[model samples]
Target chain A: MQPYPITAMALCNGMGDSTAAVLAALRAGRSGLGPCPAEFELDAVVGAVPGPLPPLPGSLERVRDTRQTRIAAVALAELQAPLARACARWGADRVGVVLGTSTGGIEASEGAYAHAHAHGGALPSHYDVERSHALDAVLHLARVFGGGLAGPAYVVSTACSSSAKVFASAQRLLAAGLCDAVLVGGVDSLCRLTVRGFAGLEVLSSAPCRPFSRERAGINIGEGAALLLVERTGEGPARLLGVGESSDAYHMTSPHPEGLGARLAMERALQLAGLVAADVDHVNAHGTGTRQNDSMESQAIRAVFAGAPAPAVVATKGYTGHMLGAAGATEVAFVVDAIAGGYLPASVGADPLDEALGVDVVTARREQRTRAALSNSFAFGGSNCSVLVGGPA
Target chain B: MSAPGFSVRGLGFWAPGYPDLAAWQARPDACPEDQSATPKAELLPPMMRRRTSLLTRMAAEVAAQALRAGGLDPTGATLVYGSVYGEIRTTLDLLAALLVAGEPLSPTKFHNSVHNTAAGYVSIATGSRAGNAALSAGRSTLAMGLLECAALVAAGEGDVVLVIAEEPLPEPLAAGRRWGPFAAAFALAAPASSDMPATTCRLEQGPNDKSLAPARPAPAWLADNPCAAALALVDALAAGAPARVALEPHLAAGWHCGLGAGA
Candidate 1:
């Protein structure tokens, strides 16, 4: 196989105080989703961060310009000090920034718009053009590093595939000698828009999301960020072996029933890595729990790995809920963690796999050494991106 | 064994108040209309038109023009659509509804607000079951689109790929941005023969530093502008001569230049 090109250093998933809650859920094979008793009319399940968000530090506040940015700020706070030290060692210019987000500061925009309409006039001076757009999050990170002028800063928003696409983009950029290192990750905050939007789609389950199960229902809306520092080096660190990106353009809201796009994306990644289907040890399925999505993905997996023994499939969305744009990076972090920890976390809430969807869906935590894993991310508009992560060759 | 690369074959563009290619080329400095009505839905079938946002409509129209100019059908062709502000109007509307009415957001609008919405819609429209991709990199949206399109072609993913870029003048977004809204697309394919035009596009890092060089005459200056690269494509094809054009890099501080010449 052509060796995986990009390596990942220091991966972190920020679930606020809910990290323990989620970890428990993972250990107990439970889902973090529960009833939302909020004033909203919708009766839906939410994979909400278990507790209050950590307070932003004064240093961060001075630079914090928006609420969503602040959410991203908090999400990255755990890694900032370590990342800073790493940047110093790696040279700031060599480090690039690629952030995937569905709504960078949409929450802030909604707030500002509300304030303006109610009171008339303009928003705070800081709520400028950059803050309103999704790209601003990456720009903010670039500024924080004092390396805005040094390297590339990109923001990718391909809906649910946004964060996953960032991984692919980062790999390409690094492979092409664009940057020696890149901070490839995603950040998204819960906003009324996303919550109501999902509710409108009638895909939000009032109970904890059950993925890949006969009784599986719908997905829970959740938000947080996951950050991974990827470096192009000859040794050490978890290597990013391959990436496949394709758009189905099949439907705006629904995936193609045949899973043609998903299959193509997975096949492309394996081909890029010069490996056959059998090389993959684990499948981190998109598994959003929606009927069409889960069923379609199951068929795609069955088609790709058909005759050969299917890889153990697990869906992490049951734990983190669907982080939307951040889902790709957040799930990738889980894959990296699984590799680092030398175990595969059970597909929380998965039980009695659907009869029609023929695949070995992992339900209980299993301790197994994994050399390579494929992480799948499918977004609206049939945009599918898959990333292959593996141990160093 | 060599890596794949993109080669431009045909180009087309459409903008408000600019009906055709000739009109757009003649009025390079034409500003966007202060206000323009949305095109009538009858132009496209309701099933196809219902899902298209303003940006998607403009993109589809421009892509069709590009295919016609290239004398190719987009059927079974790969596609790449790039826009810095993807379906911003729809996004703004959704956000506004959430803020004011606290209403249930439209699922269609929410889904269509994604970066690949237009590309996906185009594929559905053309029944092009080939690869489709979307990219964005701030001001260099078109450049990035071109880069991805070239990579796909080189990779042997498809014989021909469509690269389309569109930005619409939503009053809110255009309020402070300098450039006017426009749509440009190109049908890029592998060279059919030695006589086909040869094209090379390269992306590099550094700061944009073009002022030191003396400005060329008006015609030459216009030829060098990156936006004019689309026009240079048409010129090169028409005049059957080699052409070199410079484009501002999307990420780097320097210029990204392309050189093409027909055999």
Candidate 2:
């Protein structure tokens, strides 16, 4: 596949509400995990977007309000200029919007259910499920960007790998000549459903997550948004070289013990990019710190880079927790920054590396220029996507 | 604009009155008073079947049927699952446990709540490690999914199993959105080598002209769920004739689909 240039990116995750803040926090190896909000009875910590959020613009007032859309609005706000520029270059109709979200406004459903359970009556007026459908972000973003109403606008939802797969879908749309530019990324905000869901799975860590570390317990559910404007235009700061996806068909929750799907995704991504493990200088692993995920991902990474100089492995989940559907795009932002900034953000929570894992999990920041980097995002249901982004060679 | 299309090697469907492609084709005008009982998906191993939701079951059932009908290896094709809303019942179940019962969610139910649950189960059932994508574009989900399927085959990525499924949303949540429970699957291959003579599909980009539409009238459920649009395409494929569906108003550009005699 021909590489597509990424002209602009905007991200607002738990690590920071702005790109500059996120990059600084990454450089400083800071952990954003904090005590779970008092409202939730969970004992675990979480990575939440701090402070109040901005209200939706008057133009988007018609759209419903949910933590998910509000967070997406914040992220899209950062890309207003870039998005407008892209729409100008390629008429608004030529620009498509592809978003990923596992729980789109589930919190709204929770609130509606809570109200009905208490009052025992008709649901509230604003409690329309269709409005908060998982594809709402696509609609909201499209409306904000002016015109994707009748274009190739859709939502890719495959749990955690949702957003990463959006890149592949966007690339296909471009290769097939469906669109000239794509606003692609993901958004998932904190919701009781996701929080309690992870807790029920018993994978919610009581403290900050420790990815690829010996003492790692599980994950801290988090939320935010990451949006990138990709175009078939000239070379930019970063480019999406390739995207590969696979399914383990192994388990609904647990991944394949040998990480067969993960390995296949990485190999496929490398094959698509016309590169190999040797060409990769850094790896942003999908390390959620769960025993099964870390163990299997380590094995997969070792297999993909075997007999070659393996790239420095960095897991940013320690800094931002596991953002679920949004993690793919949010983490890719860091990979783009790593390629441009010429530094590897340390896997902050990984202190004593799990020697048994046999993978070089970076625990300290490294200042080195890298041309190619791979980002891994493996989701429940054995869905896996690996995206390669790097500086122009 | 429309690009060259793929051939419909095989087709599987589950609707109110139709249990399979042949059954549906047998009576194109039939519409059951109520949705049929969800299939048990005996094809799935007992363990896998136990873990699947009704939505996942419908998806797997149709996918397997398509592969079997086409004489294609399930392991060799990529799976593209499309839906407007995913696992709404499971989501409501988890929410009920949390908000109404004030109890922890059942781990099994929680795991099944993701949108890609069907895709995951489909891969596991087929023992396929091939790439799979789950997409939703609201009312145009089926149109967008077909576009994706056509692109994969055109790019020589691999044969594809395109499945579009949408079950009705639960009550209260279902009050405003009135979607019918339906599932449709297609075994698609690059038109250059498909064996289905009467069901080859060619895609080309064109104007968003409402003047060109499927000859068959859309079912009543088309208003509720977007994937019902497949019924029109299925009608043409079943009749073994030529048809063009204007995919505009749903897709970026208008898509002209031609069902023709195979070479």
> In model 2, how large is the Cα lDDT of residue B99?
61
Q: Which window of ten consecutive residues has the lowest lDDT sum in model 2 chain B?
A: B246-255
Candidate 1 stretches greater than 4 Å from native: A5-14, A17-44, A49-64, A75-94, A124-126, A146-149, B1-6, B31-46, B71-77, B100-102, B143-179, B187-195, B205-207, B210-252, B260-263
Against the true structure, whose lDDT is highest?
2
Instruction: Look at candidate 2 and tell me the lDDT of residue A99.
Output: 88
Q: For candidate 2, what is the DockQ-based docking class?
A: medium
- Name model 2 segments beyond 4 Å from true: A39-42, A58-62, A146-150, B33-36, B100-102, B196-198, B204-210, B221-223, B248-256, B261-263
Clashes of each: 9, 8
C-alpha local distance difference test of each model = 0.65, 0.80
- TM-score for every candidate vs. truth? 0.84, 0.95
Q: What TM-score does chain A of model 1 get?
A: 0.89
